[model samples]
Every structure is written in C-alpha cells, then in structure tokens.
Target: MEKMLSVWKTAPKAGLEVKEAPVPKIKDNEVLIKVKATSICGTDLHIYEYDPWAQKRIAKNIPYIFGHEVAGEVVEVGKGTGGISIGDHVSAETHIPCGYCYQCRTGNEHICQNVKILGVDTNGTFAQYVALPYKNAWINDKKIPHWIATAQEPLGNAVHTVFSGEVAGKTITIFGMGPIGACAVALCKAAGADKVIAIDRDEFRLGFAKEFGADVIINGATPGTDTRKEIMDATNGLGADVFLEFAGAPAAFNDGLATLRAGGRASILGVFPKPFEVDVTDGMVFKGITLTGINGRKMYDTWYKARSFLSTGKVKLEKLVTHRFKLFEIEKGMQILQKKEGMKIVLEP
Candidate 1:
C-alpha cells in the first residue's frame, strides 16, 4: 500500500488541506512521474478563493488534487508509453487534448474542444507522484533547474501572447505585472521590441518589470495616472504598436485598447471575471485594430519556443523564483501569493 502526501481542495472555499492518498497508477499509455517541483498559478489562486469563475467551473467532487505546473523525474512507464523512460526529467503539458478533436486535427490542440486540464479537470500534480499520458510529458534538459522547468507552462502563455502579433522592433505595452505579465515584459524585450512599457498597481511587480527589461514602468494605481498619454509620449505620439492585456481588470482592458495606435494589434490573454462592454466602434471598427484572443500555448510549438527561450538564456526565470516551500508548506505559499508578496513560489516534494 504505497501512499503519498497531497494537497486537496475539500470544499469550495478559501483553503486547501494536506491529506494522505494512494499513489496514482498509470494507464497503459501513461507514465508516473515522481514530483520534484510545482508552482502556484493565478488559476490556483482563483480556486483557493472560490471566486465566481471558480464556483462556476470547479466540479462538485471537491476533494481532488489541484496543481498543474510541475516538473519531475519519470519513475515508471506503463506499457504503450513510448520514448519516455525511467529517470527522464520531465514537465507536463497541462492541456491533454483528444487527438481526434477538430482543434487537435487542425493544429490548435492547445484549445481543443475536448481538452482536459491537469489541475482543474482532473487530479493534478500537487503531490508526491502524478500519472500523465506519455504525449503530455516534455523531456527537460538536465541543466534546466526543476523550478524553471515547472515554470514553463505559464511561461508558455506569456510566449504565446507576446508572439501573437509582430513584436520585433515595435513599441509594446503590457498591462499587468503578475508572474506571466512579468514574463511577457522579458519576452517582448528578448524578441526585439523597440520599447516595452509595463503597467501594474503593485510596486514590487513594477520594479520587476524594469528588471525584466521594460523601458518604462507605470503605476496604474497612482492618482491621475494616464496610461495612454504615457504610452503616446514614449512612442513619439503614435501610441504603442502592440498592446498585450494580461491584467484581467476591466479598467486595464479598456485602458490597453485606448492606448493602442489606430492600427495597432492587441493580444488578450487575461481572464475577466464577467463580461463588460467595450467601445467596439471606437476601439475596433473606427480604429481598425486587430484583436486576437489568446488561450494557452500553441500546443507543442510554444513548448519548443519556451524551451529555446529558457535554454538559450533569452529569458531568465531564476530571479523570478522568489520563494520556495516544502510540500507541507503549501498553505503558507498560498498566503504569500494572496498578498502578492512573491514572483513565483515553488513547492518541493
């Protein structure tokens, strides 16, 4: 009777509890990974708070393991699991797409109609071991640190958003400085954006944006803060060439659109709590703006890009990992994230 420690979402409330559970068995096409590192994501925070979105989405089962960003070593490979073998370092692609779906067949597996997410739709990786399909396991370079490997999933989101439109030699404005937003700042810089402006209410995250190579950092919370004017001033009055909305706040969404040049492209990856009206005529029709709604990474393509960014040092995540906790200290980690006190927190099991 092998057992493992797991963090369980026992209720639709603001806390998670540690409990003992049997180590999961792998399916014929899956492999078992001995968890090494996992990270807290904004989605995890949403579930912890049991917000309106989470209340509507999280199933009633209530006692499922709930973490997705993870990196580990393969300890067992079931029959039919090819290529992946014992002792391989790996991370998972959270979205498990059905190979036969229309989206999957058309090269949009990241948003497959029948996709299953690791933490949200099924048992997740916030435990000593997790079993996942072999196709979802991404092999990691031994040199890549465990925490960086775990950070790749969300980092992929940033990569997807930044590359959604042309970024090279363009003026870019990023609204939000959370972990993924911070990653966007760095990615935009690395991809040769002529200017990068970062906006956030949090002073710490603003500073982080600067460190990540943002040319200008704006405090969106300050009284009389004019994001459009600041962006226009920085771009020589033409407005930003590209606008990325990673902050889900309604104000940020509106401000981001307003700050874009008439023909600028906007990539939105933020999850809004509720639908809000935007001036479609003024913001899109009249302005001729191209709006792209970004979901997760572009299946395996984004994974390759994220890996290259990390391996080539084009994007550095070591500094972003501001804190670490043991498996038992997950509650403390969640508390710190709630306070917005850290960049990335990794749980070692």
Candidate 2:
C-alpha cells in the first residue's frame, strides 16, 4: 500500500486539491516513473477553469490526476517493457496512440483515431509517480535540464507548428506569445526565419518573446493599433510570408489571416472555443493561402528534432521558466497562470 501525493480534480470548478493516493502500478507494457518535474499547460488551465471545452472533452469521472508535460526517472519497468529500464531519465509523449489505428499505421500517430492524452484521458503526471506505456517514454539526454526536459512536449508542439511550413528566409508572424508561442519565436529564429514578429496582449510575454529572438514585437491589445499595418511595415509592405496562429483568440486568427501574403502558409495549433465566422472563400481560396491544422507532435520525429534544438542550445527555455513549486503548491501555480502573472511554472513532485 504505497501512498503518494497527487493533485486531483475533485469537481468541475476553478481549482485543484492535493491529496493522498495510491502510487500508480504499471501494466506489462508500461513503466513507472518517479516524476522529477512537471509543467502547467494551457490545456491544464482550460480544465482548471472548467470551460465549455473542458466540460465537453473531459470524461465524467472526477477526482482524476491531470498534468501532461513531465520529466522523471524510471523507477520500475513492467515485464515486457523493453528498451526502457530503471534509472533512465525521461519525458513522455502525452498522446498515447493505439498502434493499430488507421492513423497510426499510416504514419500519423499524433492524430491517431484512438488517441488518449496523458492527464486528460488518463491519470497524468501531477503526482509523485505515474505509469505510462513504454512507447510513450522518451529517454532524455543527461545534459538537458529537468525543466527543459519536462517542457519538450509543448516545445514539440511549437516545433511542429513552426516547421510545418518553409520558415528559412521567410518573414513569419506568430500570433500569441504564450509559452508555446514564445517557444515558436526562438525556434523560428534558430531555423533561419528572416524576420519573426510576435504579437500578444501581454507586454510581459512580449518581452520574453523578444528575449527568445523575435525581431519585432507588437501589442495586439493596444488601442488604435493596426496589427496588419505593423506587420506589413515590418515585412516591407509585402505582408508576412508565414502566419502561425497559437492564440486561439478569434481576433488573432483574423489578424493573422489578414496579414498573411497571398500564397503564404499558415499553421494553426490553437484550440478555439467555438467555430467563428471566417471568409474562407476570400481569405483562403482567392488568396491561395495554405492552411494546416496542427494537432500534436509527429510521434517520435518531432521529439527528435525538438531534442536536437534543446541539446544544441539553439532554443533556450531557462528564461521562460518563471516559477517553480512543489506538488502541494499546485494551486498557487495555477493561480499565477490564471492571473497571467508568470510564464512557465514547473512543479517538482
């Protein structure tokens, strides 16, 4: 009867509670990890608020541990779980795909029809211990810091979004300067984007985006400001060659589209609350814009690329980690996120 402390969602409300729970036991194909570090995610924030999307997506089961991004040391490897062993430092790919699904077989496991996300569909990493399928475990390089190691999942999202289109020698505009959006700024610059424009309502996040290598920063919340004009001015009046929408704000979506040049590419990773009206015929068809809906990392491909960037020091996230807390302090961490008072917060369990 081994007990562990966990953050549990006791109700469909705006909070989480720390309580004692049984340590997760691994299945034959799984491994048990003693979580060293985990980060708060925007998806976790959505669930914390019990928003409409969370209500619709989260299963009826309450009192489940929920957190996805994590890095930890393997303490136990279940029988038949090969390639992973005790003492391995690792992070996990949150999307646990059913390997036999059509999407998985077709090399699109990230969008597997039977995908179950960690912390969402199953018990997540917001605890002292978590059991995950061995396939989802990514062994971390010893040189990677625990916080950066835990951040790879979201960093992979930014990697997938930024590299979805040709970024080298391109003028790119990223709408939303949240953690992932800020990650995209550094990634795009490292990948050789000629100009990277970061837009967000929060100046604090904009400052971080600049620190991450954004060539231009625009406050979308500024009154009487024309975002398109600012982008056009920065892009020599030709408009941005690429637009990445990570804000999920309808206004940001429209602005990104408006500032995109004809034939430009747009990769959207943001999750919208509800469908909004968009002039698809004019904005997409006539303008010949290539729009891609990004879901998650491309199984192991994006993970490898993201790891390379982090290991080579091309992408630095140390500055993005603004706060740290122990497992019992998750509520305070969530509060900081809700108030938009911090960037990335890491929790050690």
Candidate 3:
C-alpha cells in the first residue's frame, strides 16, 4: 500500500490525529490529486471540536480524514474521467451532487436532494493527496496561486450571498468577520457596492477587513453599542440596502433585520446552532423585505464569478491568508482558528 500522512478523527471525540494512512484510490470516474494547499474552514472547526452537529452527523464515519477546501494538481487520472488529465490544476466544489436527483435535473445541482458534502459524507483533503469525481473538480486558471486557489470554495459562498441580489451601488452590511465574511467584504467592493459596513466583535479581523474594502467597521460586541444606528447613519439614515448574515447568532439576526431598509434584501448563509425568535412583523412583513436562504454555491455559476474576481485582481487574498503552516502543523492553525485569532489559514504539503 502507498502510504500518505493524513489528519483523521480517530475517536468519537474532539481533536484529530495525524497518521500514516493508505493513499486514496480513485474510482473509474474519479481522479487522484496531489494536494498543494488546503485551508481550514468553519465546518472543519465544527468537526474538530466534535460539536453536537458533528457528533450527530459525522460520528458514524468516525475514523475518516476531514477537510474540504483544497487546490491541487492531478497526478493520476482514472480511465473513465473524461477530459481531465495529469497535471491539471483544480479546486473542488464541496457539494457532491447525485446527477439523477430532481434538483440536479433542473440545473440546481448545488442543492441536489441527495447531495453529499465532500469532506463530511466522505473522506476529505487534509492530506498530501485527495481523490474525488472529476465532475466536482474545477480547473483553475494557471495564473492563480495555490493559496488563493485553496480559498476558492469558501469564496464561492461569499459570492452566492453577495450576488443573491443587486450589488452595484448598493449599501451592504455584513455581520461577521470570519473567512466568508472577509471574502464578502472584498467581493462587495469588487461588485461596486457604494458602502460596505462590517460588524464584528474581533478587532484583529476587523483591522484587515478595512483593507478588504469595508467602508465602515463596527464592534457589535461592545457593551451597549448601537450597531443599527451606526449602520443607519452610514446609509444616510435610510438603513443598509442589503444585509448578509454570517455571524450565526440571534443578536446578529436581529441587528441585520433592524438595520435593513424597507423593501431591502437579506441573504443568509450563516448556520445557527438552533432556531430562535425574531420580530417578523416589524422587521420583515411590513417592510416587504426579501430574504434568501443560501445553502451552497450555485454550482459552476458561483465558481466563474469567484474566478473572475481573482483573475482580474479585483479581490486579492494575500491579506486574508493570515497564517500558513506545514501540513503537520495543523494544530497551531486550528488553535488560532479556535481563538478567532486567524483569518484564512492555509497548510501546505
């Protein structure tokens, strides 16, 4: 057996174990990739911490490798993988759609009824190499660097959220400063948003969010801070034209709605721990606001938009990548992530 170093959730508990495991073998319809760079994601954090959600969903598959965001080079091409050849640079779409589903048949494969996430439902990419179906591999432009390519999957979430409605000349307020929120800031600027207001508790993240083109920054965690008033003031008392919810908190949900203008739009991608209360009458019904629940990227549509920004240099990810470590140093990066002290941390093989 050809062995490779992989990070695995060896026990049904928090933390992962790095070990020498057999390199994944590709199915006839799949391709084997030598991973160049991979990034830590919030989903990976949930699994690593063995949260309730991870315990319920991932525990059954306890001893599998776990990570999804990745960029790599094809090293072995399976016989049935059409058009994909050795040495092709690729990043995968995390949503693995079942081609025969109704959603897939209707061009909404990203929401395929039988969708199996790349890392969650199957073995994943936190290793020297990863293997997956060729359909999920998106070939990257040669000009894109490895770290930037590793970020494309998460960046697609930001694209799906920001572009859910009109962006050009609109005042957009994003609640959260995580990787996706950081990506949202840069993406809004690239799309020509007039003003981008960023709200977060973490100063470290807010500091760099400015460079990502956030016009106004607010620390919502500060005691008695009136984030709604600040956002209202930034938009000339008209409230923000759009609200993006990525904080995954009840307060952020209310703050987002409270600051949104009448008839405005809200795109929610945040995953809440559980359901909570809200004032729909005042915040939504009377206001006639449009709310779209974003699940994942719109398949290859979001991929193209994200690539255009990277290719044109409209969104530079260098600053967003706050820390880089060798693959074996995953612990250091995970600690920084848990402490909310790092943005997009990449690990190279």
Candidate 4:
C-alpha cells in the first residue's frame, strides 16, 4: 500500500487524515506521477475549518483528497500516450473541462458546464501517486524545479487577473495581500505598472508584499480613518486606475470598489464565502467602472502566459516559497497554513 495524505471526513467535521492508500493505476492515455511537490491553497483552509462552502459542496460521506497545486515526475505512461516520457517533470491544469460542454464548444472552456476539479471532486495531489489524463499534463523545461512547477496553477490566476485588462504603465491597487494577492503585486510591477499598492491587515505580510515589488503598502484595519483616502492620496488623489481584490473579505470588496477612479477597471479574483452586497450606484454604475469576476483562469491561455513569465525571468517564484515539508508532515504543513501569514508552503511527497 502507498501512503497518501488526504482530506477526509471525521466526526466534528473538517477533519483531514493521512492514510495508507493503494497506489493508483493509470488508464490508457494517462500517466502515473509520483508527487514531488504540492501547495496548500486558501480553499484548503476553508475545508480545514469546515466552512459552509465545504459542508455544502464537499460530500462528507466519503474520503476526499484535496489539493490542486501540484508538480511531479512521471513514473509510468500508459499505452497510446505520446509527447510524454517517463521521468518528465510536469504540472497540470486542475479544471478538467469536458470538451463537449456548451462552454467548451463556445471557446469558454474555463467556465465549461461539466468540469471536474482534480482535488475537490476526486483524489488529488495530496497522495504520493496520482494518475492524470494526458490532456491535463504540461511538460516544463528541465530547469524549472518541482516547487515552482506546482506554483504555476496559482500563479496563473495572478497572470490572468493582471492581464485581464491593460496593465502596462497603469496604476494598480491590490487588496488583501494573500499569496495570490502578493503574486499580483509582483506581476503588476513586472508588467510595467506605474504603481502597485498592496493592502492587508498584517504588517508582516505588507512587509513581505514589498518583496513582490509593492510600491506602496497600507494596513486596512487601522481603526478606519478612511484607508481608501490614504490609497488615493498615495495615488496622487486620483484613486487607483485598477483595483484588484484578491482578499475575499466583504469589506475588502467594498473598499476596492471605493478606491477605484471613475472609469477604472476592477478584477475580483478572491473567493468570498457569502453574497457581497455592494452599492452599484456609486463607483460602479455612476462612475462607469468595468468590473469582472475571475474564476479558474483561461486554461491554456493563462498556462502559456505563466510559463512564459516563469521562463523569461518575469516572475521570481523562489521568493514565494517560505516553507517545505516531506509527505509525512502534511498535518504539520496544514497547521502552518492555518496561521495564514506566510509565503507559499510546499509539501513534498
């Protein structure tokens, strides 16, 4: 039996366990990968806390493995597979869209009606051995380390958000300095944004945000003397031309809207737990702002952009990796992630 780290349902709920599971077998047109590195995402924290999203969406009756950010080495390739060889380093797209879906046929496969996410719907990368369909896998240059390869998934979100609208030489303000938010800060700067403002409650994170090239950092929880005003003041009193919300906090959502200049664009990439009630009359409709919600990025489009960003030295991924763990220490890894104010943590299986 091969040992796997899995998110399982135990009494008191939200409980995840690491168990010794049978190694998976691959089908034709598939490859078996021995996981080398995987990262804990913000979604994992919600599952750990048994948030409403977890209780409602995740089936509690069965053992579920949760992880999507993964990179590994191919150990076995099934029959009929081509363009891949054993020992190749790879990462995969998590949104496995059914090609026959209406959205897929319309060139909107990112929102395909029938989508199977790797970790959430089935056993994911938390295991030592994971079998993936050939279509999901992408080969990386040999120099790219497994840790950086696993990070491509989340980094793709940053790439998608920054490029959603024109970012070159634009004034960008990012709210909620989480990992993805931090990624946005760096990406915006690298993309030639004139200014990038990083907002968060933690001073430590804001400090780290500077490492991502945040030109300005603000603490959002400082007893409310109008933090938006400070952001505007920092932006020469015109407000940010683009406001990106990476923190799903309802307050951050509202603040981001309030901080945008008239006719500016905004991107919402963070996952909020509840319905956000914002006054569309102000800043949105009246100001003629363009607002877009971001989901699982454009599969191949974002992938190509992210790989190019990594390969061309636009994004330095090594700075984002703050913690590492062997496969057996997954529980400890989860505990560190629960604290919430560190850089990326990679689990090695």
> Which one wins by TM-score: 1 or 4?
1
Q: What are the per-residue Cα lDDT tens digits for candidate 2 across 1-349? A: 9999998888887777889999998899999999999999999988888888888888485769999999999999988988998999999999999999899999999999999999999999999999999999999997887877898877899999999979999999999988899999999999999999999999888998989989999997889878889999999988899999999989999989988999999999998888998889888899999999999999889998998999999998777899999978988988999899998899997
Candidate 4 RMSD to the correct structure: 1.8
C-alpha lDDT score of every prediction, in listed order: 0.91, 0.91, 0.91, 0.82
Per-residue lDDT of 53-98 in model 3, one digit per residue for the tens?
9999997888899999999999998878887889999998989999
Model 1 agreement with the true structure over 276-325: per-residue lDDT tens digits: 99989998899999999999988788989899999999889877899999
**Model 1: lDDT of residue 276:** 98
TM-score of each: 0.98, 0.98, 0.98, 0.94
Candidate 1 TM-score, C-alpha based: 0.98
